[model samples]
Target: MSAPGLLRTERARLTALYGSLLLLAGGGLVALVYVLVGQGLYASVSGVVRTVSPAYRLPVPGETVDVGRSPEPARTMAPGETPTPEELKGYAFTQDLSDAVTDATRHRLLMYSLLALAVFAVLSIWLAWWMAGRVLRPVGVITETARRLSGENLHQRISLDAPPGELKELADTFDAMLGRMEHLVSAQRRFAANAAHELRTPLAVQRAAAEIGLAGEPSPQKVARIRERLIGVADSSEHLVESLLLLAVSQEGLEPGSTGPVDLAALAAAELAADPPHALTVVRTLAPLTVTGDRALLGHLVRNLLTNAVRHNRAGGRIVVETSSDGELAVSNTGPVIGPADVPRLLEPFRRRAERQHTAGEGAGLGLSIVAAIARAHGASLAAEANAEPEGGLTVRVRFPLPDGQGAVRGAPGSKIG
Candidate 1:
């Protein structure tokens, strides 16, 4: 439905709710007043009857009574004396008058109460509707802001200026959310632009090589060289595609069914052993460490870390890989000294240090980004710090919490070699 129609429906619902609550409260108050007024009037009439009843002089049987004087006391009368017919009639009339007065007063009170209730009910509904509209005015502003927001106008905010209460709080929170959304959208746009640029380079190279090879009368040697170059381009493209896919998967998060006990220590050892760094000395301090996560993703994380360390290392440098039973995995390597300021940007996709940018086909700069994503998916903490040594490098540590029913096992303390 349209926005206006939805807003009207919401307002109507709120008005109805307010009106219902007011009606219930007003009805109870009117009922209470009706009861109290009726009781008070009845009591007043009864008091009048009690006070006036004693003044009436009724004649007694076989007794001579003065017509204008006060009636004789009952105790002074003889035991056999009985009330005359006139006295009985008079007593009945007085009782009837008292009852009539009480009934008349009660009827008048009931009529007034009903009239008051009818008038107040109408007024209550109108008042409730007005109050509801006032209360919902801020909501209307919020709705308008949301309606106007899009990718092109994500920077817009409600910025409502109202009293310090729930409405103000809601507006502030909404503005904060919009700010965050704007940041993420901007970041995503940059990432897409960079990725497109990166992908196009390899394609352009391949196209140029193919076109040149097919040109008039290419020698066999030339053809062989072109084929090798094309293969290198294809390899680079494949690596970029794989890295992008892995980054996407890491961002998408792990499914519940894919989670199980994973041995991080074993995965680290396996990765190091499979691709031994020839030029760099490798140190292993792996111990038995288990965590709950997707095994494949964990292995990918380990491999990425190992690859980054090897790819970025200097000749004859050392790489240290360590795992603790307490669910800690760390990798450090010797390379060109890295600045502390560049540590954070290294985890962002498509971001790389200037030194590594010229290393052809070595990486797509998503190695640590994928590792960070995978660590987030597994509820683990990943931290990177520039080495404190005069010779620069990076130390990346990933700490995973043990799964339920698994206790942490303390082993020898790991060291940070400068």
Candidate 2:
């Protein structure tokens, strides 16, 4: 009932069907034998002729009696008359010849009957094979259909119309499974469409308000208020736009090619050199960890984490950046302590728990969401917890699992691994 019982190949199934026909064909020969014995084939012809002769007139020595349904001849003993052998010969109508021919006929009839049986055996075998092939033809079609289905093409169906009652049922079941998968794919596409639309509406309104404020000058206090609010809106919109784009791209997949082992100490020094001269001092403790991913993307991951640390730190307070590897990679930072309840939800989109409110930036709440998504896209894990120091500060860490034999880590096995 399941599209020909896991018939992995066409030849195997054809062989099975042919074998069944061979098994049933023997019965056809048995039916032919029954007809041969039913047509009075057991009686001997000579015995039959002897029994009939006595019922008719019998001849005495040298005398003949007419066996016709006429008057008998006059008494022959008075005249001592003897019948001529010509009359006796005339009375014998192929009697001995009939006996001889019956024996030969019996042998000839038996030989012909056996020859007929042989012909029927051959005919039945050929017919059986032909019939069996006809019965399994639909099953062969279903096998080909299954072979062609794949992720690239999920919209395929089987058409069933044939004997072998179970196979038809199997095809119906396959069609049902495909239907459910198609429905799920459709729902995902719709959800993505709706989310993009909802995010765009607010971004458009915020940009309009900023443009209106910029049209005319106002008092110093009013001007500062407008400027600050516009900057805040601009920042929020930028964060949202970037988050949505990253989420979309990550869902599609990112190629993990063209990444080489990066020197963590060199990278940290470069970041420090590039930073603006803010009160937040850059502190780095780096190790020689050889981790690999998309060079551009991994660099972005490091830059974003460092920026978050610096932005959230108290003025003149230190922002620590560290990198090392344990069979792979670990990057960490320290800042104001993040509460336990907010740690897990921080990475989710648009989620900043109550403890994280009143922060410096009017963030669209996507900083850690980007980090998490990027980590997921690569084969890594990004985690957040309270810093080690009792004078509390938050520490964000990202861990990457080592590849086989410590080659560069990548997206998937044998795929683009940087």
Candidate 1's TM-score reads 0.79
Question: What tens-digit string does per-residue lDDT give for candidate 2 at 150-215?
Answer: 755668888676654787877877778777776657545654564565467556756776677555
Writing each residue's lDDT as its tens digit, candidate 1 over 282-316 gives 98999998899999999999998888888888888
Which pairs clash (backbone N, Cα, C closer than 3 Å) in model 1?
337-392
- Determine which window of 10 residues in candidate 1 has minimal summed lDDT: 409-418
lDDT of each: 0.81, 0.58
Residue 78 lDDT (model 2): 28
Model 1 spans with C-alpha error above 4 angstroms: 1-8, 49-90, 160-180, 210-224, 253-261, 278-281, 292-294, 314-317, 336-341, 355-358, 389-391, 403-405, 408-418
